[model samples]
Target: MADALTYGLGPDWEPGEDGLPFRRAARVVVLDDDDRLLLVRGHDAGEVTRSWWFTVGGGLDAGEDVRDGATREVFEETGLVVRPADLVGPVLTRSAVFDFARVTCRQDEEFFLARVPSGHDFSHDGWTDLERDVLDEMRWWDVDELAAAVAEGTVVYPETLPELVRALLDGWDGTTPHLDESSVLGPST
Candidate 1:
């Protein structure tokens, strides 16, 4: 198996002529059953950003397509293979994070949604090196759990995440209505 630490950032951090926000590249979100969202846990070297609760993805390789990167990262981080589906289109989300007490980072992230097959086991026999380590735990979280996490400021969902939830709800003809307001459901703002 290849070392997970061998991952690359692809592009170097270069200051723009005007010193504006730099693009952090794109990512993918894989939505599972029960309106539960899939998040990958990882360590951040920055002080204020010691840990991150976000989707499973990484910087796009040089000249690599976004879709390919999304698919590769998902499989690498969770052993869950997925194909990109429509949700909020290609959304460019610009946000700031305090990496350290003094260092600030503005990230421009591109977001996409992918559907995880029902009954897909992330701990299946096909997990990659990084997937096994980064995703030590995986569960189908309830809407309330997600809401609480968001409210308490624990997890950070991508900007297009809600839209993906809505899309899933719309396509799901199943019995239970797992997503509603105050969480992945409710309003799209």
Candidate 2:
């Protein structure tokens, strides 16, 4: 059999077992008019202490387009409705293999950007039971706060997120760039 892929941090991180499936997922980087980015804090399924902050998103259901999946994910996780055309990316595409809820899978992800009015209400009425169990909190963070969190050992997915947000804040054109692996976090292979 081929070598399994590995992800996450530290010595405890391990490779996936044989025959794990691959999943295609979409993520949204929701920003408010104030330039603060929205994030959700959650633990990996079946684990409590290993929480991390990630953008709003999840695996696409069968037959769903990437943009459609992203829009649906954002609404489900944040209760904010947005048009698929309003989302501004596939800003970054990445692949990683990791375990969530003790199930190992390789995930291909596309990240998109969107904006909403400041102080939009975050409602959990749409969250799945699984999401409710794993998700701990949601917050809007400035770049400085995100940098501080990284410095303080908080794990944030797409590791280059803060820099990306800063670029957007610094007048990035709406074009989406395919992020290099070196620019984000993912399996070495």
Candidate 3:
């Protein structure tokens, strides 16, 4: 069997007192005018067949607010520009614990919704070294494609992402809810 893919801190990284490093992150659920979602493919170092797809996001810098962080992450990961006020969340907060690259962490993430024009450029020019190391490709996926990928055992973060996207496209109520660990998919064990 192939080794499972992992995403988190690397071997040389360390956590705080709890043995799990805590991170505050902001993620953008980017949709095009056609309602297709944009997702990125990633692979752990040296792992080819075990790639996974995830939204555009990352840890918030100290003193940065969530909306600002979301905007920054989107631009950094995809080269798309968006105003903080245009983002439509703290739609969901996801708490997860996992081990990746031999390091374990507890990540608290906030998800925001952003809409962009179709065919917008998703360039890698803005990525940090760590992001460039793990990220492989980016694509736009319609709902059916996303659902098919999930059914085929492709790993996607938040586990509930497809449903969430559908909800948003179907007309989100604009309420922010907390997504507990049970609703999230952590690292494969």
**Highest TM-score, which number?**
3
Give candidate 3's whole-model lDDT: 0.76
The estimated TM-scores of all candidates read: 0.59, 0.82, 0.86
Count clashes in each candidate, considering only residues at least 3 apart in sequence or on different chains.
2, 0, 0
What TM-score quantifies how close candidate 3 is to the native fold? 0.86
TM-score of 1: 0.59
For model 1, residues 45-157, the per-residue Cα lDDT tens digits are 32323444566666555576777766766676567756655433353343433242222333445556565556776643544443344444555555466656667665454
Q: List per-prediction Cα lDDT, in the order shown.
A: 0.48, 0.74, 0.76
Q: Write the per-residue lDDT of candidate 3 for residues 1-189, one digit (tens) a residue.
A: 111223345332235456555667889899999999998888755344566788888888778898998898898888899999989867788888765555455677889899899978667788877677778889999978999989999888877889899999966697988877732335421
What digit string (tens of lDDT, one per residue) describes model 2 on residues 14-43? 333435545577988899999999999888
Which is the better candidate, 2 or 3, if ranked by lDDT?
A: 3
Error of 3 at 2 (Å): 30
Clashing residue pairs, candidate 1?
Answer: 180-186, 181-186
Model 3 residue 124 lDDT score: 76
